[model samples]
Target chain A: MSQRHAVITGAASGIGAATAKALRRKGYWITALDLNDPGPLADLWHPIDLDARPYRLPEFDLPVDVLVNAAGLPPRPTTEAKVLRVNFLALRRVTEHLLPHMKKGGAIVNVASKAGAKWRENIAQVKRLIGQANDACLDDFVSAEKIDTVRSYDLSKEAVVVWTKKMTAGLVERGLRMNSVSPAAVETPILGDFTRALGERSTRGIELTKRSGTPDEIAGVIAFLASPSSEWVRGCNIEADGGLTAILDTENTIRPD
Target chain B: MSQRHAVITGAASGIGAATAKALRRKGYWITALDLNDPGPLADLWHPIDLDARPYRLPEFDLPVDVLVNAAGLPPRPTTEAKVLRVNFLALRRVTEHLLPHMKKGGAIVNVASKAGAKWRENIAQVKRLIGQANDACLDDFVSAEKIDTVRSYDLSKEAVVVWTKKMTAGLVERGLRMNSVSPAAVETPILGDFTRALGERSTRGIELTKRSGTPDEIAGVIAFLASPSSEWVRGCNIEADGGLTAILDTENTIRPD
Candidate 1:
């Protein structure tokens, strides 16, 4: 049989890049999409921009067996609107556009953040925002709801978490599975954003893990979700947050930001 | 000082009523709101229609020391719209309206469900939805998102969990605290909802604690969050789900829907 194809976003850097290389070494053909070129780690490269939604994937003759959405913007000086546009709208647009090309037994794994853990508290709004197919309507809904841009980053990841579960029941019948990975404070360029917002105590003071995770650490879990090992897993998010969430649950400490 | 005021919602039955009784016994002057009369447990009772938003909570002479939002609908055959209106919108409307009556060192504990544990995944969307206040716009927002009514129950609770955390920072600036209690399968009138939707295996198969929790058990946690004991907790959610979530966390099982 021909090698399986895995389409990965954010393939240029961080978890996305790490996942692209890992999947490649694991014998899966990688169709990498990102704003940056991944050098030679990827077999087929799509230099795509995530800001533009309704993202149409290039034609693929081989069956796309896995989809790994890893592209995202961390909390920074950018507007929250842009954060939602890239992390959520773009991810959805690409997934829906690519779904028909995927076959039975295929899977989708979106990389979410621990920061968006409160998503359960906001499922109604999540369903509301995810219903919009493109940028204009989604932003319109966001504006009407009056969500400030400051929260766009965490909120976008939260949307992906809900979308992952919401799409599960329907996707399973079509012979597809979906899941998300909520990583806690991975050591990436984005770690600085968190440190600034949360102070040095953010990473140092609390946490049983005691250190941030590496990109490859996150990629390992991403690969597992995209594989058949997680067949019975169904619509669940793997909290590969280094037991920080578990510690929080045990300590009954701040229910996590 | 005058007996501190504690405002409790869903005081008609289940966790809400249990929390009211627990708070009252702990020396709080209970100002209870519910669709049904509290009979005699309440010092002052307000008959509330949760389906109605922007509810005019009756005037009170004393300051509110704690606000416990325990109102909700279980997963059943109901329009997702109605579920969102009641669980999320009404909860928000009442919480915001009553904020003025609460002083520094006050606390808000929203009774959420383990079913909404996926809330961590939907934080961004949750924030967006929570930013909105009324029914029509919220409905329009939900309709735009195209969420099915079938998952409304879990979604609403998820909203509550996120709202609890999201409001913490702002509320604390005004000298208030906010948190949520996510209970697991409880032996309430609605325990049947779990048995029906998830089968008997839902409760029996999983959990370190074999039996479902009681309303008073959840109320105990609610009272703690509302008290000075949880003063340093900050913006977070307290999971009182009898180790079910902890088990899921360890086993990496399907996230509770």
Candidate 2:
């Protein structure tokens, strides 16, 4: 059999970069798309801007074996529009445009944040946030919903998580699969943003299992989802955040008599 | 104290109607909103079109102690956009408009379906669907995401469940609370939708715990969320689906080696 091709966004640094390396080791050729050049592991590199306005996805060869959407904006002093666009709208655009190109038995893996763990909480506003394509529309959304950049990041990740579920049937129709890996407080360049948004004491959750996860650790989960091993794990969001959400779930459980 | 006012949406039938009657017995003056005339269970009634474009909200007397959003479109022969608009978008519009009217110690209850049981699976798309307003936009969403009407209803309820989680901080800041009840295969006007969507063989999960929940039984959960009895249950989504979800969760559990 011929070597399969894979596309990974946000492949410059962090999880995307690590996933590219991991997949390369699995004998899959990588077509990397990121804001910065994803070093030598990429069999083919597309050094495109992640925050490109109006969001036009670059063309690629058909029957791509795997698509990993690890591109995203972290919570920091940034505009909510950019956060939503890069993290969600762009992700959706890429997936929708590329759906026709995915081969049977292919898999798609998305990266979401644990900040989005409670996405089930305020879904209406988050949905509106996801639809906002430009600054004008996003401004209206942010003002109406009172969402800050940090919340925007959470909403974007939440949207990514939900989008995976939404795209399940279409993928299943074609005998393909899709899933997401939700990571929180991992050791990445964006770690400071999480520390700032959630505070250092919030590390107590991560510390529960000892320490924060390395990019390679999260990459392991992404690679698993992208592999034939997790073929039955369709439409699932695997929590790869070092048991932080599990701790929160434990706190949330208070059984009634 | 003066009688506390409560607003109930979709109060003409099903869980909304049951909740309206249940709340009236709790000494709250019911302000019922529905597409149909609520048959005398409400102290005040507003018969408005549920499909009003741009979602114009009705004026309400302030200091509402409880708000129950039980209005929804079940999976029938309907457009995906209409289902999403009625079940998710319109519900959001009402809740956002009424947030300020809620006084301290207030509580909000949203009726979500068990079809949304897998909300944790795809949160991102659920948020976007919840944000879609009209069919033109919802059509773009449905086509872009490739979501069907049944999936739309599931996404809508998933959004409701998650929306309840998202509003926790804002509600807490305002000294108010919000929660949702996810009813599964309940014997209601909409139960046929579940049967059609999931089929007859699916009830084995529901039947494991005996019969499906009655509207009154679900109303009991909604009433609990609305009253001071559940003050500590902030941002919680109560699975009032008579243990079907529990069975599914047990089936999903992968015990550690």
Candidate 3:
């Protein structure tokens, strides 16, 4: 049997890099995609900008049996235009490029965040965007509105989680699987970027979890989604935030801004 | 007190129409948006081609206090390009457009479908998209990708839900609320279109609820989000599906396709 191939985006750092290393350790051929050069991983296939590039099968050049989309940022208050373009808009671009090569038993692992819990109430607005989902000028729409960059990110993530479920319905019949993982504050080297994005006051004390999760810890969950052991898992977003989501629930306290 | 202003998309039919009537009944001046003519709600402002038009603030010469994005299609297997565009691309455009005019105690409600429950396992892809939320050309990024129309609806809704939560961190400080609603087979007049979009097999028994819910039923939940009663309900998506999602968990024994 040909070795199962896994595609990892954002592979240059944090969870993406860790996920690539872990999958490689498991004897899987790894195709790592990132804006930054993927440093010394054995048998690595790196790609230029995923958003900008034409999605060749196995986006990194090898045939991919599994795809892990692990690139993203946290939300901050800023330009609405920028946020929508990046988080949700760019994500849709990446998914389109990768779909044709996904086979039965093939799985897609989408890295969502714990913030995705609010998916049930805003039906009206979500539907509208879904209606516009067809238009090719998504950026023109945002640009015309002059939206702040920060707000667009949050909206983009919301769209990504929603699309994961939608994709599941489409992929189910094809014997392909699609699911998402939402991690709460993994202590990725990118944690600093997250910190900068979220003003100090907002991120303060929220780090009550004595230890942030390692990139490897987050990757373990991704591997599970990609493997046959998780075949039955469909459209479920596993939360791997060191029980912080549960803790926030226990307190019934909201994440303070 | 000045009456709150609301911008609603897809207001000519189904949930959009119902939500428009519901909001009007609640005494808010409605800026109803849709491709179709607004019929009798002529007194209410209607924007043609919400997806194509630039989202100018002071819509109808009034600052929008709330935004209800209730437009989209059912899930189906389609070209990957179409799926991403419909599902994620446009959603970012509308949300980013309206964020500036939204004020303290303001709320943005997005409408998603029950199909988006699969985000837990796809964390990486979600992150990559989420990362773009802050970029200057996020929506343009989507336009450049050339996604399809049908599948994009579901994916966009998923992104919408995720983005709502991400925005909470920032919006909370501004006293603005962002939330989503996911319905399971509501009895909207648009059921036929949804069924067509969802394709034949899955549509067989979709209306398994105590008869499908009316747009009014779903609208009540949306009104709640817009009211002071739900001020603390930030970043929440209430499932108004008459427990269909929960019941599906028990009734359907998922089989790997």
Candidate 4:
């Protein structure tokens, strides 16, 4: 019998690769998907260019038991369009295409970010403007507005969290589980890009938490969500940021003036 | 001297109506924007359908000192498209559109919901997929997929939180402020829709929290975000949620039955 199958996006490197390796250790037969031919894991890795491609299941077909949408673009102003296309739209395509193949009791783990936490304050408006725009309108809006940089990255992830929350009920009834993981300042190659996109001050603040996470540290959480152990955990966004999100008490103050 | 100009969306009834009243009482000029005309606020009410028409500034254009995005669709499945359009897209339009009209120290408060807190778990994936879809894609995807009502509501709110975070850097540098207010179960007609959408079990859970908030209660938080006292607070999703989010912990604890 085939070992339980797992599919990971952006599986060539970083957290995606780590998650694939972790799942392999957990006895899953893996199919790693990415733009590069992730050699050595050739039997598992399926090269994919998300921007130019639609996720056709035949491209990397397996009886997918667990899916980790780890494919994404990091923060960068120059790569804004690529970021939206790859990170947001492409992620949705992969999920929508693969969701049909999900086995009973299968799990889908999506990676978001702590940057998206504040969306609650403005979601009511998002809900109102859900589907009224065409591609032309979107393009027109973007061009008219001249929006560039990592804000798109932040916005795309905001939609991901929304989409995940939107899909949990169907997944539940189908015996499939869906959840998200938001990590802060993981020590990855993406660090350089993130620092460049958002200034040194902000990056330093994230790093000051004294807890730049390892790939495995994040993989562990993804693994937990992808595992049956977290079956009841639906529509949850687990903050693996080591308490960076907790509000500081300004009252117990020491001023550096 | 111009009375402080305020733009309130979703002013047809409920929280939007209540907020318009509250802001008017504070001696601010009000310009209510909604599809349905909420007759007789103090200054003016501009009724327009955001989804069906393009927004145009009024003839008596005063500088918008405070803009409150409160227009939204109630929590219902068929209404998901409408919800997302008004709640997310329109809010973005208003904020971006009015930025030019806003004074240096202006405030923008978008009314979000408590359901958005789950972003930490799936932060990576969420950051990937926002604002990249065209209308056709969104419609096709939303229709083909079965969404969880509660999760959908929460997800839309999560997008707002993310947007708020993205706006913070710009707002601070420009001497403006942007924040979100999330109420728990509010005593609005939407509560019935929310209860019906979430079904009986979760509705009971909300009631157990012991404080179904009033519109004025949430409006108070919005007013605070609009005021100078909240200057230091930018990109914060203030939870007027009556601690319902706290229950996320108790429910997560595994108990031996």
Clashes within 3 Å, all models in order: 21, 20, 119, 52
Model 1 chain A: lowest-lDDT 10 consecutive positions: A248-257
DockQ scores of all models, one per candidate: 0.02, 0.02, 0.02, 0.02
Decoy 3 TM-score against native = 0.48
Residues forming the 10-long window of minimal summed lDDT in candidate 4 chain B: B248-257
- TM-scores of the candidates are 0.51, 0.52, 0.48, 0.49
Evaluate fnat for each of the predicted models and list the values in order.
0.00, 0.00, 0.00, 0.00
The digit string of per-residue lDDT tens for model 1 on A1-257 reads 67889999898888898899889988999988888898887888888887765446677777899999999987665456677888898888889888999989898889988767777576666656666665866556667877764456667888887777666656756888777878877777777877776565366523445457788878876776676644444456656554455455433532433
TM-score of chain B of 4: 0.88
Candidate 4 CAPRI grade: incorrect
Model 3 docking category:
incorrect
After the best TM-score superposition of candidate 3, give how far the Cα of residue A38 lies from its true spot, in angstroms: 0.6
Best-fitting candidate, scored by TM-score:
2
lDDT against true structure, model 1: 0.73
> Where is model 3 more than 4 Å wrong at Cα?
A51-62, A74-83, A129-140, A143-150, A200-205, A253-257, B1-257
- Give residue B32's lDDT in candidate 2 (0 to 100): 89
Question: For each model, chain A TM-score?
Answer: 0.90, 0.92, 0.82, 0.86
Every model: iRMSD:
13.3, 15.5, 14.6, 15.5
For the second chain of model 2, what is the TM-score against the true structure's chain B? 0.92
